[model samples]
Every structure is written in C-alpha cells, then in structure tokens.
Target: MKKVAPPQCLQNAFEENGLTQIDVFEFPEGTHTAVDAAKAIGCNVSDIGKSLVFVTETLNPILIVMNGADQVDMNKAANLLGLPIRKAEATEVRETTGYVIGGVPPFGHAKPVETLIDKKLLEKDTVWLAAGTPKTVFSLSTRDLRDVTGIETGVDVSA
Candidate 1:
C-alpha cells in the first residue's frame, strides 16, 4: 500500500510561512482526536495543539489553538474577541477554513481567521498540531509557532 501524503495545502503552508525545517507526518493509527493524537505521537495530551473553530454572532470564523487537555472558555473567548461566539458547525468549519473539523491547522487557513492561542501551550517548547488532515500532523517549537502565526503573546482562553 502507498503511504498517505500530507495535504498539499499543508505543504503550501510550509513554503508560504518559512517552515521548511518542519516535517509533516502521517500516523495511520487515527489521530482524529486529542487523545488519539497523543497516543500516536507518544506525547502528553497537553502537548497536542488542538486547533478549534468558532463562529461569532456576525458570522466570522475564529481559530483558537489550545492544548488538548484544555477546553475553551466561551465567555473568555467572547470577551477577548469582543463579540459573542459559538462553535462552528462542521460545514461552516470546512467552508470557512478550507479544512474539516478535527483537521484544521493553526495556519494555512483558506481565509484569514482571527486566531488566539492558549497561553498554556507556550509552556511547552514543542507541540504537535493537525496538518490539514486528521491523520497528518507536524511539530513546532512554541516560539516558531508564535512567529509564524504573528501572535506572539498567548491568551488564557482555556476553561
């Protein structure tokens, strides 16, 4: 059987964002959820960077990159963005981010999405994130991730 390749969108992102040093990986054991990804990568669940999508009342998409062990506090997220927001539906998540739920990368979005990182993620030197596919992932230093995303300071978005 041929090995699965990481999505081209993820490749495009590497070139676009100066991430040539990072390598995308495919773990066939199903890294569709935080627990699954952690087990596959042999890392702590808190080291998994889960990219989540939310929709504001005005229909804008927001990407929150947080640790797998944490949950986004809706009230804090709303306050941080200065708007009311709710979880985006699967269709909306796909339509807005050009990726499906459970596969959304922190970067490489189809459109520019307002992004916030959970401060806890910064505590670790490196974290693993989805790479445009549920079974694909890539690791990045917390510092490089901040530089790439242009969000140097993380927020306490976790519950």
Candidate 2:
C-alpha cells in the first residue's frame, strides 16, 4: 500500500511560517476521534489537538484548536467572542475550512478564520493534528503550531 502525501497548501503554509519538521502518520480505518488517534500515534490523548470550527451569530467561522482530552466550553467561547455560538454543520466546516471534521488543520483553510489555540497545549513539546484525512496525522511543536497557523494563544475556552 502507498501512503497519501499531505497537501502542498499546508506544506507551503508550514514553510512560509518557518515550521519545523511535520510528521505524518497513517492509521487504520475508523480512527477519527482523538482517543483513537492517540492510540494509533502512541501518544497521550492531550497531545492530540482537535481543530474545531464554530459558526458565530454573524455567520463567520471561528477556528478553535483544543486539547483532545478537554471539552469546549461553548458558553465561554461565545462570551469571549461576543457572538452567539452554534454548532458548525459538516457542510459549513467543509465550506469554510476546506477540510472535513476529522482532518481540519490549523492552517490552509479556504479563508483566514479567526483562530484560537488552547492555553494547555503550550505545556506540551509537540502535538499531533489530522493531516487532511481521518487516517493520517502530523506532529509539530506547540510554538510552531501557533506560528504556522497564526493562531492566537488563549485560555478563553475551557473544559
């Protein structure tokens, strides 16, 4: 079997932002959630950064990079952004981020979405994220993630 390489757009974004080496991994089928991803990658669940997209009341897309082991506090997120929160539909996610639920990267979206990085991720040396597919993931440092993704580091959203 052959491995599918990551998209050039994401690679370019990483390079343009001076990111370190990006490690891509291929797992078995149905490994979409973070727990499954952690098992596949042999890492702690908290090391898996889940890239979530939410639709604000203004119909704008907001990107939230959170710890896999943590829960997103929608109320806090809504309060911080001063916008009503609605679960972003799958179609909205694809339309805005150009990636599906399990494979949304912090960067390389169709447009620049307002990004928020979980403060907890800062404590980790590296984190794993989906590489445009449910069966694939990539590893990079927390600082590199923020730099490459242009994500603002914050603690607005809590578990």
Candidate 3:
C-alpha cells in the first residue's frame, strides 16, 4: 500500500513541534470513530485518543483529549476547569480547530485553545489519534504526546 501523506496542517504542526518520530497512517476504511480507528490500528479502543471540543460558559473553546473507552464527565470537567461546559457547535468547532468534528486532531488548531487530556490515556505507553482527517491517524508515546502538545500530566475528566 502506498503511504499517504498527512494533511498539511498536521505536517506543519508536527514539524513545528519537532515531532519527527510521528508517522501518520491512512485508513481508507475510515477512522471516523474510535472503534474504527482501534480496529484499523489493532489496538484497544482505550488507546485511541479522542479529541472533543467544548464551549465554556464564557464562550471560550477548550479541547479535551480522552480515551476512546471513556466518556467525558461534563460536571467533573466543569469543576476541574472552573466553568460550565457544553459541546461546541459544528461551526464553533471548525472555527476554533480548523477541522471538522470527526477529524479534529489533538494539536494544530487554528488557535491555541486550552487543552485537557484524560489521565487514563497516560497509562498507555503508546496511543493513536486523528491526524487532521477522518481517514488518517498517528501513533505516539503518551509522554511525547504531552510534550508535543504542551499538556501537563493530565486531568481526571473521564467517567
């Protein structure tokens, strides 16, 4: 199979972040869902890092990177963030992240939105995440993920 290149947005982000080791894979079958990405990558669903966007009560955008096996506990997340939160509308998501809902990547946003990663994802040595497109994904160690994205250890925002 010919290796398809990652989207320019992802490529620029990876290069700018010095994530030279990251390699993006094309999933023609589609990786729009965690289950599909897990099956394609031959990993547990929990190892797929799902990126979700939310709007705070202040109308600010925030990104949550959680394990595929878990769901965000909005109340807990709100408490942790010290603000009420709700899912971002499609327009808000695209405006904030420069990507659509099913294909939002962890980094390379149009703007630098506040980000929180689920602690559960840190338990794994490696994890997979969307790469600027529904049909592309990339693998990285949990440590490298945090480093590249400038995220701290993580938060217990998953239920």
In candidate 2, which residue ranges exceed 4 Å CA deviation? 1-3
Candidates in order, TM-scores: namely 0.94, 0.91, 0.95
Kindly list the per-residue Cα lDDT of model 3 for residues 1-159, writing each as its tens digit.
Answer: 125677787789889988876778887888888998998888899999999999999999999999999999999999998999999999999999998887899998888889999988988899999988888888888888888887768889987
List all candidate RMSDs to the true structure: 1.8, 1.9, 1.3
lDDT values, one for every candidate: 0.88, 0.81, 0.88
* Candidate 2 global CA lDDT score: 0.81
Give me the runs in candidate 3 sitting further than 4 Å from their true place.
none
Q: Give the TM-score of candidate 2.
A: 0.91
Clashes by residue pair, model 1: none
lDDT, residue 16, model 1: 85
lDDT of 1 by residue, 57-85 (tens): 99999999989999999999999999999
- Using lDDT as the yardstick, the better of models 1 and 2 is 1
